[model samples]
Structures are given as structure tokens and as C-alpha cells.
Target chain A: MSECIVITSGKGGVGKTTTTANLGVALAQQGHTVAVVDADIGLRNLDVILGLENRIVYDLVHVIEGECRLKQGLIKDKRLDGLSLLPAAQTRDKNAVTPDQMRKLVAELKEHFDYVLVDCPAGIEQGFKNAVAGADKAIIVTTPEVSAIRDADRIIGMVEAAELPEPQLIINRFRAKMVQSGDMMNKEDILEILAIPLLGVVPDHEDIIVSANRGVPVAFDDESLVGEAYRRIGRRLGGEPDVPLLDLTVDDGLWTTIKRWMGLAPAREVAR
Target chain B: MSNPAPARVGGGAPVVVRTLSAQSGADGVIVSVRVDVAFDDVRAELHRVLGQTPERWRNRMARLDLGDRDVELFDVRRLVHLLKGDYGLSVTAVYTTERAVHRYVSRELKLQVFTRDPADDCVQALVGAVGEAGATAVTEVGPHAIDSDGVTEIVSGPAVTVEDTTSFETDDDVVEDDGAIADLSYDDESGAAKAAPEPEPDVVLPVEPMPIRIAGGQRVQSIPRSLRGGQSVRFPGDVVVYGDVNPGAVVEAGGNILVFGALRGLAHAGSHGDEAAVIMAFDLRPTQLRIGGRIAFQGLEDDIPRGPGFRPEIAFVTDERIRIEPWRGRLPTEQVATGDAPPSTKTPGDAAEAAPVTEQ
Candidate 1:
């Protein structure tokens, strides 16, 4: 379906851009024309994660200012079919584009793409307002912590106030062992505080950082657990039936135990 | 002029059109028109009269006599416009007996109007002194206008009141000026009658002085959306919020405060010191509750939902202190009151004396 969805977290450093890039790749890989827009005007990271940073010529501000056509500003990914990126201007501030311009841009993008995912900036400022102006749905990302959950609750209230449909939640960087050890909140706790539908959870993994450093989305890696989590999320958004959550508990698998007994791997989970 | 001389049409039959005439005096020239016929006939008659009068008379001040015939404001304004604009006649006063015509002429047209019977002797003598067309009598009758040349003397009309004469007294130069006649004799009975077109009946409004909550009340201020942190609302009446009042928000009302959702902020009802005002909310985990002048700091333990069920609660003043209770959906002292109140219905705030009903 032709729709625009904004991914936002009220607080920063919560994996919002990572989730957006992965979902955009996974959706485009499913043979759907998808456009991922970076709504963060000054601090843009979506193009870097999508590995299309070097191909940027005309950015969002240039298109809005009539300096370039919408097609000219859109950077299509050569690595994947039916995937494009609209990078934000890094030198300009959020005030460079208003909410009305973003709405018009999103509307024009929706006319050409099957899915338009907007990576919203942090906080409830003008940037946040501009990102959600034309979005038909919202996907809220929050980590399993009190501060993040509180901010998520506030964001939920704001998203509902903006008149979008009830946003589904993405519990990012969830650590099951932390919950088991009483060191962090569980998914149920975050869901109870935010009061939204749980879309999918991405376990805390090193693949996200590695993939981000290499300027590639983790969802392109088939064997990566985080990639599977994001693909399931993309499938759910595409009307796929519910898939079971990933097992993120301590490494007690038979293969892992045999490896540890053979002295090939460490007996304890590695410290961060 | 001589009443248009009763001219007949070419067929030698008398048409008997409405008459138009003019008389001049030191008070002003009076142009009386009997407009009881069609507007076309009045226009033709006015054109024929102006054709016969001396052209210099158009520059002199003129008072129009509407003469007991009902006239609309449109016809009056158009007639005045024709005399003032087309014929160049300066019309400053009007004489009409109808209150509606008088009100229109005096207030809307801003002209002096005399609302008396036309057959009065003072008006006739005043007409007689101005009988000799444009004669020398300065009929601006005052102590200064007495018998200036003796040939055209000020024949003070018998019906002229002392107050009328005193008000008409002007300087010697007033009779020579064009604008002096405009302010003559309009603040009399005519101005008072024109002030009220339809007589209004006396109305007395009932005022209430009590601060108690009656069965029916006054205005209720409503906020339809949630109040985020740092947002505050203050109202002089009862306040009803359809959404949550989040932490760090404040809501103060002179009457009862009602929140449809959670109230985790501070709420002060009866800010004007009406002690009966109560604060009600669906989730009443407030940081502080103040009713009237008394403030109560809420216990922090209730910040989390203590049980599985969520019920609306109420806070009100009890024994000079605030008391929070699980609301039973109905006021304990309120009766369904079908002709007679229930025996358990005490005063409105007597919740401590009655068994509260289960919340709906």
C-alpha cells in the first residue's frame, strides 16, 4: 500500500535510524518501491547507514527550494532494486524546512513509492512536528529502560495528539539476560508504560554497529539475528502473520555448550 | 411660493396633485410638501415648483414640512438629497407629527425636527411674518430681533413659550450666517420621543450572591486535549478536562475540577475560596490537591497503580482538611428527589455521614 510512516524516539541514541534503514531495505528487497527520507536536518545518518551517502547531489532542502527536481534529489541504491534515499542537508538547521514543505514532499514521494519511511529527529520540536505532518502511521522505537520508556510514553501521547493512527512499538536493543538478572526492564514493562502494540523486538547485537560502520544495513545480511528481527518487522508491516520472537536469553544452546566444552569459546558472555 | 397655482392638464381637467410651497423668515425658510400621491407625481410637482421660485432662494436655509403624511426614511433622504444636491437648497430643519418620521429626520438625518400639530397659532403667525416673500423681518426672534425696521416687525407668535424665545436668542450675525439655523430648537420633546422608537418595558435582572453549588450551575470551562508538562490552565468557573493532566502541569478553577483521564499534576479547585468545590479524576494520583485555601500534599506511594482495577476518585474538604476517596459515581447526599428527597440525603458534603454507593 502507498503509505508514509515516521519512525521516532523522543530521546536520542535509541536506534531509530538503524530501525528505519533496516526496515526500508527489507521492504524494498521484497520487490516494493520504498523511499527512506532523513527528516533529521542537521544530524543525518540514514544515508550513511543505507550506504548512499557518496551519491547525494541535491538534498531535501534543494528539492524544497525548487533548486532541483524531486527525482534529481532522490538517490537510488545501486546495490538493491526499488530502493531510494532522500538525504537531509547537513549544513542547514531544522528551521530550513517547515512542516508544510515536509508534508508536500512526503505526499509527492507517496505518489511514486509503495512505502515512504521517515526517520524523525529526536525531541518534540519543530523537526519532530515536520516529520509527522504527512505520515499516515507512526512506528515508535524505544529501548528497555525507564528513561527511554518514559520518553516513549510522552511520544505516544504526542503521536496520538497529532491524529495519526495508534503507533506500533519497536523495542530496540532488548536484552533478555538483563531482564532475567533484574538489571533492566522487560518488553512487557515497556509495553505497559507506553500502551501501544508491540511490532517486533531487536536483540542487542554487535552486527548493528558493524553494519552501520561499513555503511550497510544489517537487514542485507541473511544470517544476522538483528537482520532476521528487522525482516520479520518488515514482513509484519507488509501484512504477514506474526512470527515468533527471537530467543535472546543467555547462550545456553547445545551447540554453544559443546563449543565451550571443546574450549573453543568463552564460558561466559562477553562484556560490552 | 403660491402653492404651485393649481395648474390643470392640457385636457382642461384638474389633476389636483399634491401641493408644494415655500415661505421665508429670519428663523428659516419653510418648504412644505404634501406627499400623499405617487413618488413620480411628487418629483414632477417639486420640479415644477423649483422652476417658478427665484434662483437665489435655493441658497437660503429651508425647513421641510412633511405634514402628517407617513414617509419612509428612503423617501425623506432622497427628497432632501434632491433639494440639497440638484436644486442646491440647504434644508436644515423638518416638521413632522409622526414619531417614526421624526426619529428618522432628527437622528438618522441629524436635523432639527418639530413634532407638533401643524394647526397651532404660533406656527401660523410665524408663517404670516414670513408672508411677504423674502422680506426684511429677521424672524430669528430674540431681544435683538425686536422691530429692527418697523416695516417688517418680529410679530412674536402668541403660542411661543418663554423657553423657546430664550433658546432662539443669538448674536446679531446669526441671521446673516447659513449654518446658524441648524442648531435651533431640537432638544425639546421631539429629541426625547425620538430616543425610544418602541417604548421598552422595565426589566429587572436577578443577581445571585451565594457561592454554594446549586442543582444547576454556571459556565464550565472545558479542555479537550491532554495538558503536557509545563502547561497550565486557570479558570474562574468549573473546569472539565477531557484528557490527562500530565506531571508538572497545573489546573486551577474557581469551582469543581473534573478530569476525564489521569491527573498526575497539581489541581486546585475553588481557587476563590469556595470550600465545597471538589476535584475528580479517573486516575487521581495527583502531586498535590488544594480545595479552597487548604492544601494537601499527596502521598507518593499512589503514583503507581496499586491494584489491577482503575476507578475514578474524588477529593474534597472534610473537617477543614482534604480527604481523598474512591468515588462511588454518585454523590452520597444527592437524592433522585421525586417530589421528596430520600431520608439519607444530608447536605451535599456529608459523605462521612452516609454509606456510599458502589461506583458504576
Candidate 2:
């Protein structure tokens, strides 16, 4: 049986699209056929992130409207054979597709793919409704900011209202340096607010941004730490019990290393 | 687009108009007039609606809702004149999203102008409000009006009196209209004519009390464990959390909220718009806090100190802005008298008494 998962965050710029692309790539890398559907119709970036925008001949709307067959609209990812994308129409708005239509589309995709990850748009509007409608599970994405966490809480409530199972949380762009310095919010703080089970924490890395700008999923790059986090999260979703959450603690300088070896420094204590 | 043929009396084109009659707090009726076209072009429609309204509704007050359009002073004055003079509808308030229209309606005409939410659908809004008051025996009216009996159904009967009274007291229109009247009488004209005669007999409009009843909720819902993210708890009266309100959790109450532990999630008190409602916690580091209509998010201040020094804080709406201060057991009346002046000592007591009402 295929599980349709919606990756959503109520606040904008909280890495919902990035998480969607990386997870799709991670799952596909594990030999599972995965389809990442972009539900953010007008503001689509999933195809670009998956490096398959140029290969798209027909989009989701075209398939839904029966202008093209579903096979014609599914753009195969350049990196993986098992992964594909059903790209959103950049010209059309979110209302172009209804929740019932999304359910039918997901049901069809279930016949071919093992997992379907729907990338939801920001806000609790038509886009959000359509994204959660077809999904059996939800993956709420948020940063370590109070504003983002607040929005995540709201999205959780909405997902529950939609009758989707308890959504998991992914904290992205987490900077341990700021968190240790008592400036930025930490994992504990975030977890406290959104009491949902933690999927994994993707540490803040500039390579993730660069990969996105270059039209590539960071999970494809072995050198990227965020990619490793995504892979572990992907394993966790695959029902692996032993995939530990990422430790985003900053390890800088020789003194900190010495303090760490001696077990003298508190975990959250900053070196500077 | 071709304009509809002009109406004989108003000389403006006949536009589609929708009039909604709703029950007021007082033993009377409140009607809202909605125009589909521009505010300036709604003269004929308003005229038609007002003309057809039953004579029994003559003394009732009505609000003009200018959907998505600004109102000029001339247009507002004309509507007010038509409603009050010809129809005796007593145009007391106008609702619009346009700032200029709000200014003209409030300042120039000395009437209340509510800043209507842009997302509000007229028919649905009335129905939603009526749905909340479903306990009140609603009667069917005309085709458009959801209630069939009458708008004044709640007025004569004591069955749904308390809730309706609460609704009336919190009704922004009644309070705003009273405020408008007070403002006009207190300004220039009253000062100029003070010595001439009996000081324009304080227009004792039966305005509801300022700190509207922060009392009488029989039950308090208590949560034993720390609320985790993705969890939500809502109660009609007060809510007491024995544990922390963790991040991503939501706790909403109609009255006030008291958290024995840290409030790190979204906490909303007075979800029904009672400005007197307050949210108090041992260490209030809420991601977002809402009291009545005012909302405040965390990180608004760059220098907010967290941990150990995390003093128990109380959040309440003051002068329309959500203000947070250390919960010092008692409201610092002398401090407020010397500093702010408006929120006196009683406010602190009111806040304390508001939540503890349902406490066993």
C-alpha cells in the first residue's frame, strides 16, 4: 500500500519545498519508487529542485484536465530511475485543482509508486486543503524560529482536522552556534512548542542553498551533512527504528575538542 | 459594462442590494445593508431597501457595509441622511476596509466606522454569528434572512438572554457608536456652549460596562500533562494547565488562562474578544500570545532574556495593543497611576478574579 504524505508549514520560507525534494531523492536512493507532487501550483520550485524542470513537457494541471495522459506529465528525475515528479503549472493558481481531484490523482499514482510526497503551499487556503486531502500522513516542516514554530502548530491542528494521522516534524535550517549562544531557538524549544514526534533535524548549511540554486537535491551530494540527515529521515520513514536524529552541536577549535574529551563543558555551553 | 436603468427618485442606477436583519443586544433589531456595486453608486439600492423596510423597523439602527469600496463624505452623509431622516433607520455605523472611508465616516459624520475584514463573505458572516446564537429560538424571516421567526425574537424572551447580553456588550458597533457620541459632545461644540446652559445632558446611552463581566463560568478544564507540539485544547471558560504548554501546542479559552508551568506554545485568552482577559504563566515564553483581539508574537524584542531570569509574565490587551509584564501577584495600581493612568488598580484584580472564578 502507498502512503501519501503532505509536507507543509503554515509560514513561508520554512523549507517545505526543499525538504520535499530531498526526502524524495533520499527515498528513491533507497530503491523505492517515489513521486514528489508539487501542490504549490503558481509558485512551483519542486521540479527545479529535483533538476527536472527542463524535462517537463506536460504538467499536473494538464493531466488533471485530461489534456495529456498521466504518463506524459510525470517528469523522470535525471539522477534516479525510481524517482519522478508531477510538476505544478506555473501559469495556473492553486484553485485550478480541487481536493477530490487530488485524491483521484494520488490514488492513480499509488498504482505505480511506493511513496507520494505532496509539497504544500504556505497558508491554510485552497492549496493546503488540496495537499492534505489525498494524504494519509503529514510531515510538518519548520525552522527554529518562534514564528515558524507557531505556524507549524497551526498546520498540525489543520492536518488533524483533515483527519490525517499525527504529523511528524522536521526542523530545518537549525544553527547550533546561535542556539548555544542563547540567541536563537533550540531543538528543545522547538519540540516543546510542536509536541509532534521529531522526524529529523537538518542543520543549517550553505551547501543546501547552493544545491537548490543549482537545481539539485542536496540529498544527492554525499559531502552535504543535510543530505545525510535527509537520508536518515528517509530511512526512518521506511520504518527503520535505529536512525538517530542529527546532532547539530557546533564543534569548533581545539579548546572545545579538549573540553569535550574531558567531559568538562556542558553540551549547550558555547566556546566563544 | 452597461449600467442598469436609473431609478426615478435617487437618479443613480439600480444596483443589487442585500439587507440583513439581525438581533441586537437591546430589545430591538439591527440591520446591515450591503451593496454589490461601488459605495457612491449604492444610493438607489439603499433607497430601495430602506423604502421597502417595514415601518415597525423605523426606530431601529442599521449599519452600512460598503463591500470592498471606499466611501466619500458626500456618499456617507447622503446615506446617513436618508436612513435617519426618511426611513428612521438611525444609521449609527458604517463598515469598510478603506481607511479614507473610515476617517470620513468616523470623523466627519461623527459616526462609528468598523474596519471590515476583507475576507468576510456577507451572507456567511451573518449565518455564522446566528449559528453561534443557535440556543436562542430563531424564527424564519424573509427568503434571504436565515432566521424565519424575526430578528427581535431574543429580545422578548428570557430563554437566551445571558449569551445575547454578552454578545451585545461585546458588540463593537454599540461600544463604538457610544464612543463616537461621547467624542462629539466632548469636543469643540460642547466646550463653546458650556456656560450657556445645562451641560448637554450627558447622553446616557445605555452603554455596557467597560470591563464587561469577567465572571460566571461554572467550569474550569484542567490538563494534567505537559502539552506537546501538534496538540490543542480549547475550553469555553477558564483553562488551567498543571504542566508546561510545550511549543507547537495550542491552548485557547473563552475567559482567561493560567499555566502553572512554562507557556511556550500558542496561548489565546478571551478568544471571544473580551479585552479584560489575561494569560498568565510561570515562565511565559510563548511562541505567540493572543488576548482578546490583540496578538503578539515571540522575538518582537531583540533583547528578550530567556531562562532562569524567565519571570512569570502576564499578557493582556491594553489600549488595543497586547502588553506583557511581570506577574507581580497584584496589578501595580500606583505604578499605573503614575505611569499609564488609564488601566487603574481594578484591572489587576479583574484579571486575577477573571480566571480563578472556576477554580475549585
Candidate 3:
């Protein structure tokens, strides 16, 4: 049966949309029909990230408002065969979609797809409610930073308040080298604060930025470390065994070490 | 101007002293005497007015010139005293050494002089002259003290004594002795309206009549309202409902809940925060349920189960995970009954409970 999963993080800029795009791509690549619905209405960016902005013939608001059929609004992604998107309307506000309407839409999608991943907006406002309304489960994405973890904890409380199924945690953009150097908070510390089951850790990587800028999700790039991380997160969503996080630290050679000591050349940046 | 006034009485003298008769000013009496004396005499007069010894005065006087005249004065203390005395009169001293004469005059003086006989009559006449709006001037003759009693009588209102006129009544007149303003009437035949039954002294009925033991050596502290048959139920501990619980019903217990029935109404388990608390219904349907935080229907779904033992259930989360589980046929009863239900217990059953009929 298809499962409606909402990827939500209470704090903004915590990789919620990125996770939704990558997970949907990863799920679709595994031969499962997947639909990524962007719940952030007026501030729509999911279509841009998926590089399907120009292909949008109808939006979610038009479908919900009865101006367009649900099938008319479903944009099939050319990158992946089974992957489709229900882009949020940039012209309309969040009030254009009701939780009941979202529930009905997700229910309809559940019949055809193996996964319906909703990209919830930041904050615990109406957008969040609309996104989480029809979800069978949730994936809370958070960074290792204190504020992000705190917000994730608040989101966990909210998800629990909604009485949805238990949510899994995906710690995104973790800096392993910084964690080793004691400069960054570790995954264990994040889990201690959030107190939710850990699904996977996504390392910080420049390729993720490159892929995001090019409107291609990192999960599609098998060679990229962050891309592999996104694939592991997708496998985890499919109830696969836990995959170890990537080691992002750069090895120091003698010349590199000497340059580091001389403060001439910078130390290697961590990879995702 | 006729004959140059035959050189006025104290004119052209370095020191001029004028003593006018008492009937000169507007009050018909000159209470102040102006004297234009030498600097030394002026200093002596100042010392006298201030009741200070002449030795206390400084010899070197400060010279002050008014227009073209120079006057030497020791201090301004004497002028201050004259202004504050009878009739509130003031004086200005002028010493014209260049002109060879000093002129001194009372700046503004109006005094009422007193006579020994018919002194009260003069006082009365002064009072009448001042009336309510004009200035009232009264002078007493000799060393006699002024009668303050008459002034006090005219200014003050008459005094009267107040007594506590409130009367007391016997208890019989006031029925229902609580003293509240409720209608208090004593009908001899109708037994003195009982004191509204002293609020039935906080009867602490045992909330938990019987406790049921669950797993982990934790006992269900209160009996489940479902088993209690529809009685206004309150459990001292946790209540476990085993059947379809009804609405307009209450289930309060001290421990936790494991309902095999569809929980329809208010279900409060661990009314206190026994972090080990939980609430699990087979159908998992309820109007409102509270383990701790107030929970209302976030949304209602029609696909919920209706009958008993159709779906297994368990709920428990303390500072960590809040979970619900469906009873699989293979799982032990104690596993579902205890607070330590497995995380994987939530399963979708084919025989889903019918939609809970919620009372509007």
C-alpha cells in the first residue's frame, strides 16, 4: 500500500525541500511510483529544485479550487519515469489549500503510488498542518546545530500532538570533521535533544549545493558523496537496513600538512 | 510755598526724626515712627529691635547711594522686623549726606489703635467695617490678652455628639444562623432551614476500588470504567477498557489504559503524570482523551474499528516516544496490556472498526 510521508522540519533552511526532492527521486529510481507535493503555496520552490518549473501546466491550487483536475496538475518528471510532482501555486497563498483537500488528494495519490512525499513548509503554521494532514508517517529533517535540533524537537512534539504515526529522524548536513574537532555538535548530541529514532545522517557537501543550483537533486548523482547519502536516506524510507554515514574529512598529505602549518593553503573542506 | 514753610521741623539736619500723632494713617493711628538718624544711631536702633547688644554690631558700615545720596547702614534686619509687626507696616530709610538731611518714611502703614474703655466696642466696629469682604482690623489696649473665644465661635460650626444607635436582635429572630443575606425565616413547623447542609464534608471515596495487575509488576491502580458498567466512574489509578466505551462517559484512573473497546468519551488515565502512563484502545477512537496533555479530535476518520478484541492496542511514552499499537493475534495478552508494548505493534487490521458515531 502507498504511504503518505511528510518531510518536515520546524525550523527553516533545514533541508526539508532538498530531502523531499532527493527521497522522491531515490524512491522513483527504485521502480516505485512517487509523487512529491510541495505544501508551501505562495513561496513555491520545489518545482524549481526539481527543474520542472517550466513544465507546470496546472498547479495544486487550481486542482483544489476545481479549476483543474488532479491528473491535469500532476507534472511527470522527465528525469525519473515513476516520479511526478504536484507543484504549489506561486500566485496563490497557503489559504488556497485546506487540510481536508490535501487529505483527499493524498488519499487519491496513495492508490497509484508507493510513496506520496509532502514537502512541508517551515514553522508550525497552517502550511505545516496542511502538509502533515494526510501523512501516514513523518520524516523530521534537522541539522546538528542547537537551534535546528531544538526546532526539530518542537516539531516532534507537534507531530505527536497531531497523533500521526511515529516519525523517523534524518539528521541532515552533519559536519563530521567539525564533530571530530569538537567544533560541531555530533549526531549523538542531536539525538539526545530530539529523542527520536535516527534514520540516517547526511554529511555536508559542496556537490549538494552544485546539484541544488543546477536544479538536479544530489540523489541522482551516484558519484557524489551527498548524492549517495540521499540514496541511503531513500533506502531507509523504504524500510531498508541502516546505511553508515559518509566520512567527510580530507586526508592530509605531508605537503598539505606543511601548507596547513604555514597557513598558506587552507585545510581540505569536508565532503558530504 | 508762602513763606518757605519756616524751615520744616526736622529739615536740613543730618539727622531727622519725625513722630506723627497716632491718628495719621488710614487706620487712624500711626503705629510706626520714622526716624532719619545718624549711621551710628541707625545701627543702635537695629541692635535694639533685634534684642542684640550694641557691641555685636560691626563698626565698618557698608555705604549705599540712592540716586545722588549716600546712606550708610549696618544691616537690613530692622526693616524686616518692622514689616512683620502690627498693621504689617514697612519702612524705607533714605540718608542724603550730600543734602545734609536723611528722609525716612513708612512705605505703607494702616493701623488701628486701641483704647482702654469700650475696647470690645471698637473691636466690634472694626469687625463690622471689615464685614465679610473687607479687611478686619482689631486692636487690644494695654497688656490685656485678645479674646480668641469670640473669633473661634464665629469661625467654627456648632458641635454635636454621636451615639451608636444600632440595636441588637436575638438569634431566634435571625433564622439560618450562618448570617448570610439569604432569606431567613423561621417557620415553627418547618424545621429551622438546615444550614444548607455544610457542603457534605469532602468525602474522599476511594478512587480505586480494586486494582488490576499488569506487566512490569505495575498494577492497574483503578478499575476500568468499561467494566464498571456505566456508573459515574472514577479510578484511583489507571483504567483499562476492554470493550466499546460509550460517550457522555468518564473513565478516570491513576495508572494507564489498555482499551480493547473503542474509546468514545473522556478517558483520563494517570490523572497524575506517571511518566509510565499510557492509553490504548483497540479501535483507538475517542471524543477526547488525556494521558497528560489535553487531546481533542485533531480530525475524525470513518475507517475506525467498532467492536471488542478486533484490534490489539497499547500506548506508552514518557519523555521519549508516544506510540499506539494494534494487537496481532500472535502477541501475548500481557505484552499488549503492559505499558511496554513493542514499537512495531501498530498494524492495519482488515476488520477495521466502523466509524465512531460522534455526538455533535
**Which candidate's lDDT is highest?**
1
Which of candidates 1 and 2 is the stronger one according to TM-score?
2
Best first by DockQ, ranked:
2, 1, 3
State candidate 3's DockQ. 0.01
Candidate 3 C-alpha error for residue B283, in Å: 37
**Per-residue lDDT of model 3, residues A27-112, tens digit only:** 89888999999999999889988989889989988888888888899999987899999999999888888899999989998988
Local distance difference test values of all predictions, in order: 0.67, 0.66, 0.54
Candidate 3: where is the Cα deviation over 4 Å?
A: A242-245, A248-272, B1-360
State which docking tier applies to candidate 3.
incorrect
- Residue B276's lDDT in candidate 3: 38
Could you tell me the lDDT of residue A39 within candidate 3? 94
Report the alpha-carbon TM-score of model 3 versus the true structure.
Answer: 0.43
- Measured with C-alpha atoms, the lDDT of residue A225 in candidate 3 is 69
Off by over 4 Å in 1: A181-183, A245-247, A250-272, B1-251, B258-262, B273-276, B287-305, B309-313, B317-360
TM-score of each: 0.55, 0.56, 0.43
Interface Cα RMSD, each model? 3.6, 3.9, 16.7
Q: What tens-digit string does per-residue lDDT give for candidate 2 at B202-278?
A: 22121221222233544567888677566788865678898888777899876678898988789987654444568
- Leading candidate by TM-score: 2
lDDT of 3: 0.54
